[model samples]
Target chain A: MASGEAILAHGSAAKRPGSPWLSGFVAATISEIKSLYREPAALAFTLGQPIVLLVILVAFDFHTTLPNGKVVPYLDVLVPGLIAFIGMTVGLNGVLFPLSRYKERGILRRVAATPMPTGSFVVAMIVSRLLIALAVTLITWIFGVYVFGADLTGSAVLLIAFATIGSLAFIALGILMVAFARSEDDVAPLMMLVLIPSILFSGAADRQPRPRPHRPRHRYPRPRHLVRRRDHPGRLALQDGVARYE
Target chain B: MATIPAPTRESASHTAQPPALRVANLVKHYKKFEAVRGISFDVQPGEIFGLLGPNGAGKTSTLEIVTGLRDATSGSVEIFGIDIAHHRAEARALLGVQLQESDFFDHLTLKEQLEFLGACYGVKPDTEALLGYVDLADRPNWRLKQLSGGQQQRFALAAALVNDPPLVLLDEPSTGLDPTARRQLWSLIRRLQAGGRTIVLSTHYMEEAEELCDRVAVMDRGVIAGIDTPLALIQQLIDTGFKREVVVRDATLEDVFLHLTGNTLDGVSLDDARKED
Candidate 1:
């Protein structure tokens, strides 16, 4: 396809004002996941990165207290943050990166031609990510609370809200990536570059550093996975990665 | 003017329900530029209407509107008396569309894709039967990426027929196929037309429009420059009747190559590459 025609489609799809929120969101998310899961390399990157981070933080973790006042399993606190973290990862890394490639490969153009409402397309995407995020949330909580002692002061409503907003933030980031990406080949590296910094900055796996509380508290939500270890020899880099649950 | 014969109108209703399709003063504007500017036409039941145009000539934009995929900036589209502007879903329920560059999951088998589409169309016919119709029943295990371009196109065509809707819109069905593959596809399309289905197609290739379309709408710059049967369209351009000549080269390469290799579409064994390699 010519570049101008493809650009026209991208504009319309992104600009559909009446796009249905849930179904369109779900369909778009589903298609993104569908394409992502189809690629073994991408799957390894998206799912593997989070699990590997969790394991590294646990080995070097300094945080023993859960978010609640009561003494609780570190795993309990770690699990919920992981939900928000994985969501962030999937949004920026999983959905956005591939969407750039999709634009280059003309997937969006092909879909734009169909009578399928653009609203439906967007809804599908959001739904797919939410579903995957939900599943990951349930599994991690069940395993963490039952297998290890942990506490969650979070209400079901609060948890759901967190995932939705977190998802939107990630989706916005993903669209921005698509807008700026120059070619299909650049998508993978750019996604990794953007995602690594965001995850690291959010303290998804903080370990050794004793976080000096922000002078003016960070208005942005950050997941604190680890903090300074009292008597551990594990490297500070690893400890800072585990500071979120301290 | 001679009126068309009113031999019969058979369906759930016979209340002179408008022609299967009608368009009047259809216009679409992209800001100040008009992609489709007030073109009008009608398609009777069971007619193969071809909209011929070059790329960027608004052929696709018009078809999209007719299929209720996109709303026209101005004018009307009627499908069996249903207004497309007000009843998109109802208008669209009667059409099936095959776009030029469709893609599905690479992991999905041919059977899985057909079954999924069938469920969406709400016509759950036997999966094997549908596969057989597309001539891919034996390759059900093969992934979508594994199939040749011809196989993929045929799979798409079969998927379009899953609902067996009355109207099928094929945008450049033979765009990238080999000659034999193209011929086979045209034959399959003929079979569908013979079964009393209405088909509308867009093509840049003049020969394809000439060979397949029962009637042609020659469009240029988003307007119908002419409309008639292919022969009529071609003939309308001539003031005096003329005859054409044919020549056979001593040994055309295509014949020699085919004679040596063989000419068959299902003969993929001749071109199959090992998956590991």
Candidate 2:
């Protein structure tokens, strides 16, 4: 057939890197994270974006009153921003961000040269992103819980899962972005101009009127067992002037 | 087109040595177009071996296969009595390859890069010694983007040696360097060889191959046309009674440029490039 097809056919037998044993996998995972931290520009842009937004949203007062005549609380507004931030961080870090550098400078080819097992590179990349994304999510939650008093009524695990799946969705998008990106210069504009807008429209920013899967709850769905700590957002509202002061 | 030198058994004797690296009947193809058609040769240990060929002659393809970058269609790469097909890691551990290209984290220091690559080979080396070898000890803290292209190659070479591997691959190491920088790199390669490292390098420079390589493999269209010492290959073209063409050509324009501009890659441009204060 064609040359591309021939290359693909050969790629079907693409040799793998190293065995993914428990210890080896973990080592590869750490190496991947180290690689990410090594990149100053990428880490700064990826991690700093959300933090900057978080500070801006919390520190600045928004005077928008809700439909119920209750003020639209900063925490309520900040919740969607945090979710969007987490999703973007995970998806964009290695996905489309380094594709150009990898292609232009032969980083991917060099990495492929190492004997670190077949999928180790990708796995390491994803795992590192997941860890960093988790850190960002936790940081956002802490800021919400202490600084803004977010009303998280659902299961903590479910929230984490939702955020993770959200991250994965964007990460896939990021890979697709990389695939489309031809040169190193194409990456920055692609992310800023294309990826960000799509994510914002995906209902991550408002908890806005979007269709979500309504899972039928078992009548006695032990929602109390989810978090036992003192995290009553509504109660906090009552004690703290009901989002009127801060 | 260079003539294929057919030598009698006696002439082959003067060139033959124990093989540091050996390949037998190696073949790799994209589909119908064979990238490395059948090629074979032996590289002696501690000698700088050069694989010279024009672009698309399978120079890179062969290097990739030998260094565990790309696997062959069907062939064998043996290094120091270890076969690549079976004991890949063991064979690879014995060899350090300076890939034709690589990526480094922009945030990491030269020292940190060395450590990461050393760890890749499970090597615990004196990163200091490695840096000193490449003349980059002073700028260890600088990130990759801060360094010039030539310095980056130096750091890459140091990383390749972190394991103190017996066999090293240098692919087009001198390709982008200026004349003075190229001379500096040649000296460094000589030093590494002095330390008893077997180096296999690929390049298009006929002069460089004649100067640095003890044994040479000339390739065309993914196949080996000739494998011998540079002297013998040149001698093959001249029938008999060969007078050595050993006249030193006057120092060329690069030398003139070096005389006019000096050695170091000016400090003023670096100040402008350093974005981090």
Candidate 3:
């Protein structure tokens, strides 16, 4: 809390369009953080959901034994899946719930009346939630590595790239969801409806039901060099390229 | 790109400043409905202007357009000589707005709410004095959800005044208040006016208009039915030979109710308390 004179001084300073935009951005971010920290339920739900899921995943211990007498830890396999799951859940729920609730409660309308741009306000909120998601993911990844001895087989850069893409995708989906939703009440059901299928069916799901392996035909024998996915155009193109090479 | 508002001739001169707020030929069309149609008005620098209307008269729509919250079909709004369409942030800096609803983050405490909103305006407010000014100093740590209706509205008022802007826009500031609370709000509004702050508010209460507004714009069906000082409007009606067959008594039912109810301004009133439930 500052003095009245300080506030007046700041107000006069802010009146100029020439004033640094960063101050307003910083203020909006701080406001977003304050509101976020104040809501105990929201804080619990966001942080708790991932931890609860991790607990369930660890308890399941769904493992796979490799061909070379090596046993692959289930947590290692599940970690990537969990990352995607966490990314999607955080990206969708983190942004949509508050955004829709704010719109429904006229908070957005009220902020729209202020000097702060709604774009910047919304961006601040999303960025804060994204940071929270980053923290949650880091914690989960640490637990996977230390507690479960999960092997990090792939490039960390690749994992990060995929996570970032997944996050962006889910956030875009969340914004689309909010656009269709009339109010906060509309958000919950829509999220549940969308997320349940995604969690159950997406490749992020634990132990996806492997499809039947396709057998090559004798007439136009599938190229051994190309991975088998007869329905995919990429596989077809690869087969054509292999034939041309042959 | 062509939508940018070209600098108007009026703002070119330094001595002749633009009005505090100006809306010209404003129209808002939502699908088949025209919420505000060709409406226009100018608010002076230090006047308490009232928009008196019933529900669905487009007062909020007009206010929204002026605030740059919603796009108009075709119109222009200038605040402190800056066209809102071109320079929304610059113009918004000159305005303080208390929306029609007491919409705030439910989790944040009163002090936090003030600080958060103040930060949004890039202002560092004296939250203690601000809360004290709005008579909520004692309950600085109280969350928005914990506040009674009247208390919340008052807190919202404090939030609105956090930046100390020259013009304040209040949309139905006294809508849900008890009679006592409404009076308290009226006094607060008067205090602002005395401090030379320009205020434009919308309310349905005729008494509120007569008591607080320097000029009233009576709106009906998305257009201005009439605009004048409350007294002048009444005087015009009187001069036009409009009369009631039955003379009204000095004390109305509301006055009797207030007399019986003892004009409770405190947040402990049953209606105010019921908000939590």
Measured by DockQ, the strongest candidate is 3
Candidate 3, residues B155-197, lDDT tens digits: the string is 7777878777888899999988877677767766776666667
Clashing pairs in 3: none
List model 2 lDDT by residue over A1-246, tens digit each: 011121111011122243323333455567667766766876686567665665554443332333454444445556655765677756775667665666677766655554445365566666777777776787777666655555555677877888888777767677677777888788888888756687678654554321111222223312221321433222212223344222
Listed in order, each prediction's TM-score against the native is 0.71, 0.73, 0.80
TM-score of chain A of 1: 0.58
Q: How does residue A191 of candidate 1 score in lDDT?
A: 74
Positional deviation of residue B192's Cα in model 3 after best superposition, in angstroms: 0.1
Give the higher-TM-score candidate: 1 or 2.
2
lDDT per residue as tens, model 2, B174-276? 8888765666666667666665677899999897888778778899998888777798888876766678769787887866887765434532222222221
Candidate 3 stretches greater than 4 Å from native: A1-21, A34-37, A65-71, A204-246, B1-16, B248-250, B267-277
> How much lDDT does candidate 3 score?
0.71
**What local lDDT score does residue A116 receive in model 3, on the 0 to 100 scale?**
72
